[model samples]
Target: MSTGAAADGGVHDFGCRGGDPAASAVSGRVSGTGEGKVRSLAWNQGTTLLRAWRAGVLPRRKKLLMTNTNAPSSAASLGLLVLRVVVGAIFAAHGAQKIFEYTIPGTIGSFADMGVPLAEIAAPVVAFVELIGGILLILGLLTRPVGIVLAIDMAVALILVHLPAGLWVGDGGYEFVAVLGVAALALALTGAGRFSVDGAVLRGRAPAWLS
Candidate 1:
């Protein structure tokens, strides 16, 4: 015969199947209560504490929808993954227009109208940077350099053309362009993610150099 405590804290008797008295005794103490207690802890504090810890130690993990041992964190990577394709397609299309529909001088004239200096030279340079930089950004190759150039290009556009327009794009204002310029700068800083060519190239490299 074996004697034990039941779930409600009462005594229970088993007729001689007592393989191990110690194990049976422990199992009785909190078999049901232990699980209930655990549930209570989770409700009261465990889950929240776990979430807070994750927030503090690895904030980047919060943003990652997928996981890999190797990943990129900088804006350049995020921009490439998030903004590259859209920006690239638009830029390439515009470049095609400059190369085909509009002559360099014509584009330069437009820039001059927008108050850009050295419109003749700046026109072709801007077109090429957009055309090429867009492609590079989308490809996740040389993302930092490409993002920097694109950010600069947008900055110049904002200063020369949009600033005078005011805030609303509907009002021919600089507001929309200014927002885009800031986003571009953010991309320039972060670089492409782990899936990018930049990440592949920088793999096994020192983090200091990359930062």
Candidate 2:
């Protein structure tokens, strides 16, 4: 973390505007301190900013925005709640359809027809996992685990039943499962957000990976 200005030739005006007061003032002061440090000072409207870097580093105007460090906004939580409700309901409905409407025997027959391996074993597991996971998701409890399981469930459906049909859902393609998988994976990674039961209990006290 060395600190000093760059050499004269190192300074470049990034402001675009000609004769900018801040750029003009800093022009003459740019000079290397011979300690492998670089710094820049810019001022406008009686405000001053000084930044330093080492190891040939320089200031940057563009930065990656992949992370969100600020506290979750209420609107964001609301959005998460909506997403959870809708997606969870869909999953739960599918699960219920398998167990009640189709029945275990029927699901097994369908799985067998689709050439799914171990249809006898997988039928019940997939049904209960979706039902339980979907309920958990709706309640915002154990969301991450539920999300992962559901995502995997969707992935298996894609591979076994949907992928070979092409990209359109009308053709029985994987598009629907793919969307559900990504959505579930997103929930797994993001957790239930501030509107969830996890938020009410964890409150920053839970382990990072779990939270």
| Model 2: CA > 4 A from native | 1-70
The per-model lDDT (C-alpha) reads 0.71, 0.78
* Model 1: colliding residue pairs: 74-190, 75-190, 75-191, 76-190, 76-191, 76-192, 77-191, 77-192, 77-193, 165-173
Model 2 C-alpha lDDT per residue in residues 1-211, reported as the tens digit of each score: 1224458556444442464657644643453332224222323322333333332223332122223444567888788888888888889888899999999999999999999999999998998888878888887887887898899999999988999998899999999989989988988988888888888997578775565
lDDT of 1: 0.71
Tens-place lDDT digits, model 1, residues 105-171: 8898888887789888999998888888778767777766677777788888878787777888997
Clash tally, candidates in order: 10, 0
